[model samples]
Target: MGCATLTPVPEAWRSVPQAARITDLCARVSCASRGATDVKVTDGKLVASGKDLTPQFRAIQSFDVSLERREVAFAAKRSDNFDIGLVSLDGSDIHWVPEDPADETDVQWAPRGNKISFVVHSRTGDLVRTVHIPTSFQLTADFPYTAVRALGWEPAAERYAVVLTSPEASERIERLKYSGEGRESVVAPAVRLDVAIEPLADALLMRPSTLHYGERLPLIVWITETPFEWNDARGALMRNARVACAIVRQPSEAFWTAARAVAWIDLEKVYVVSGAPAPSPAYPGAPLSATSVVADPKIPTGRYRVDDRIVRAPPAIVESVAAGWIAEQLKDRNGPR
Candidate 1:
């Protein structure tokens, strides 16, 4: 037999393909030294004045520069989550900001470098955390909205604006006033209720591994009657499939109504897997028409009649079955992956 060379398949064609990119340098170019030096993070390195200053080992998510001190405040992945760090303009000296278990992003320097602020993503809710550099004092103000990023700080560092993203992926600016001891409240730019109130504050959202920018994908909303927790099977569903999942607890009519407005969701492929009986007619004239329903066998089928189409499976294989069904539905629609 003649010797032949084997060509490796492209990542897109592989079943277990890696993501195209996972860099944290999402922010734009930041200015330092009173606009004398232009600094930014790219390819895991800090570039200042067209020169790479920081080491390439650390993965930076978002960053800001202090004009007074000539230091860069950046958020980088520490372990499972992200942490804030400080680096000199020369990249020779590095300091650690106060670490938190939750992921911290959008690091911003105060006007005089006396304080720093970032948003912390906690399981229960989102918090805007501020730390004083001199006293090392930490102050946190809880917010009901999901903070996308820190916009800017006030001159006194007691107030700031953050971009809040609703469940439907719409963003709006909200200003918050901060005090050292009390819980800060929204100061200006009230929440817009023109469309629908922001829900999904308690929902646990999971995205597919190989998600692309500005790409719409199928969604599976698991409406849990009780508390939800992460397990191996649920993790596998997200890792192996090319669909977005949301675990919604105590889902209200507004949730279903707002979900229809999400620009990135393929409304035709939105499926609901409920642990309780089918929801009532309180959902604003039946806005969301779920593609399919995957009910828990333990719960009596209220609206749906159990037939041969409904396959009863064990708890271990439920996620697998759900993934397969979603794939089949996507195939039927001839949707793009």
Candidate 2:
């Protein structure tokens, strides 16, 4: 039996219903483009064709679709200006987020699609930042933050992982839980988030948990020239060795590590990135970055992959494709899709 029949796999997986719904949506969109609009009742709107109306967005550098929210959050850049936005699946209006994305910022949707976080460029430097999807409250780290490598969370969970490199170049993974708003009798309500980062790897490759559910966060690895020594979060900072095999090694070599799917290769069947061309490998040496990546890989273990070839896509194009996928996967189901 599938842990989730509608879903399974890393940044990638083989979802039958997902494809069927997407195909049907595409057909409807094709008809709409030809001026034959046929509307269907879905949890969310599906915009297969037309414009999302964010003309200023030059390219969608990082993006993800939230099937639960029926929306897509993305970071797009034009010249030196970068903006973040939340767009519905119906190709309607684009709602601008208040986040001031640094060149390094990549919009991330929470596993539950309730929260969003990213790195922000401040006058001092870069900082780890977060914003709730509903309330739109923002949180910024006080310290001198450098970059956000990856973020992960357990399915339907409040606890999340934030991997980062300090300005001094030290790498750490912060285990965090959303603490909601803080209110005082005198002051207005403010957002509060609890975080504790343990110095885990000098270089850790994070295959973050997906917006859709899986058993748990995927098996992350410390990069090296040889086969990966899995870095399960059980050995995370302050954790008192739940598993005896939790060996800790300092990161010496920095190889680019990313995941097409969040689960380990053995756990989920690898699925190819559908509706994508052959990977161009164009984003070479851009730095190890991962935010909200959605993929379905149907390949074997030890062959993890992601569709970075599409990273160079214009913001509208990426948003369009991702928005469509989110809308199609928005069916009411028992399993994560």
Please report, as a residue range, the 10-residue window in candidate 1 with the lowest summed lDDT: 17-26
Backbone clash total for model 1 is 0
lDDT (tens digit, per residue) of candidate 1 on 217-319 = 7776765532223233333344445666776765566666566676776766666654343444422422344543444455322212233223222333344
TM-score of 2: 0.36
TM for every model, in the order presented, reads 0.47, 0.36
The alpha-carbon RMSD values of the candidates against the true structure, listed in the order shown, are 16.0, 19.2
For model 1, state the Cα shift of residue 105 in Å: 0.7
Q: Which regions in candidate 2 have their CA more than 4 angstroms from the true location?
A: 1-56, 99-104, 142-145, 167-169, 179-337
Best by lDDT: 1
Give me candidate 1's TM-score against the actual structure: 0.47
Give the top-scoring candidate (TM-score). 1
